[model samples]
Target: MTYCVGLLLETGIVMLSDTRTNAGFDNVACYRKMFVFETTGERVVAILTAGNLSVTQTVIAKLRQAIARDDPEHSIMRAPSMLDVAEIIGRTLNDVHVAVNERMERTKYSASASMLVAGQRLGGQLRLFLVYEEGNFIEATDDTPYLQIGEHKYGKPILDRVVTPETTIEVGRKAVLISMDSTMRSNLSVGMPLDLLTIRRGEYRVSTRERIEAGDPTFSAMSEAWGNALRDGFLSLPG
Candidate 1:
């Protein structure tokens, strides 16, 4: 399991994902779930994946291979717009899932993965999409300027209450980190270090990419502040 969240704001897009993959109580490891592709001032794409590790890795590898070929029809780098990029990713994820599941059928194992894809191309509007296992996706809209996957329930409340299409990128970053912090406290399957990426409107490139590891002072301070605020609010409620 994992927790990945992406916020779409007027200023830009903010995305974050944890790096923990647990096969069982005794088998736990860290693997980055965030992948970014960009050509400065031309285009930028970021993918946050969650679900079966093998399926997700294979899907990413295939996407990379397609880009290496520089084939406009199959490469996300050559996709005309962010919408097209999302479609390509959706189709690839679905194909990989089917192929892997077929190979694992006799063993009774399941292979499935979902992803949050967001980016922009030169002269195109910034877009964010949630791609499901069925080769279909939904785009983020003004009414709901965010998308989440994996153990999303634990981190959704803050986003619902604090995020908005008009929010600034700086505030958006803090909001997402708080959202991740909430999930980390409640779920053991999602842990540090975390990958965070930010893209500003009109830049056509990723402006910030960070990794927040365990014991990181800035994140730790934010987490503590949020906890204290929650307690204070609870205490102020009439009983």
Candidate 2:
């Protein structure tokens, strides 16, 4: 399992994903869950995936092939709008989910995966979508400016209390990092090394992209600070 979150705010979009995959206690490894496709100032799309590795990898590979071939009808970079891009991704994810599940039937394993789609096209509005296993998705709106997948429950409270459609891009990044920190602390399956990116509104390009490795000083410091703050807050609460 993994944890991925995307926030769509007035100023921009912030997304983060963990790089952990585990089949068992002894069979654990790191695999990036974020994929980005950008045409600099023309268009940009970032996908954060969570679920069966085979299904997610195949879906990403096909998406990349479409771009490499310049398939106008299918390439996300060529999609007329962010909505169209979400539709394309949804359809592809659904197809791959079904195909892979059939082959895994004998083992009773599921090939289902979900993804968060966030991006903007030149002159288009910034948009975010959470695509489900069935190929359908829901957009993030003002009432709920964020979407999360995988080991999400442990990390959701901070987002619920702090994030809003009007949140600043910098704050959004911090909130996501703290959220991921909380999830990693509570879940053994979700481990180190994280992918983070941000796209400013109207830029049509990624503004920041970073990978926070295990034991990075900055992240470790932030995590420790947050933990201390939480402890103090709990102690201050009335019994």
* Model 2 regions lying over 4 Å from their true place: none
Q: In candidate 1, what are the lDDT values of residues 1-239, reduced to their tens digit?
A: 89999999999999999999999868899999999999999999999999999999999999999999997887999999898999999999999999989999999779778999999999999999999999999999999999999999989999999999999999999999999998998999999999999999999999999998899999999899999999999999997
Task: Give the per-residue lDDT digits (tens) of candidate 2, residues 13-52.
Answer: 9999999998888999999999999999999999999999
* C-alpha RMSD between model 2 and the true structure: 0.9
lDDT of 1: 0.94
Q: lDDT for model 2, please.
A: 0.95
In the predicted model 1, the residue pairs found to clash are none
What TM-score would you give candidate 1 relative to the actual structure? 0.98
In terms of lDDT, the poorest run of 10 residues in model 1 is 104-113
All predictions: root-mean-square deviation over Cα?
Answer: 0.9, 0.9
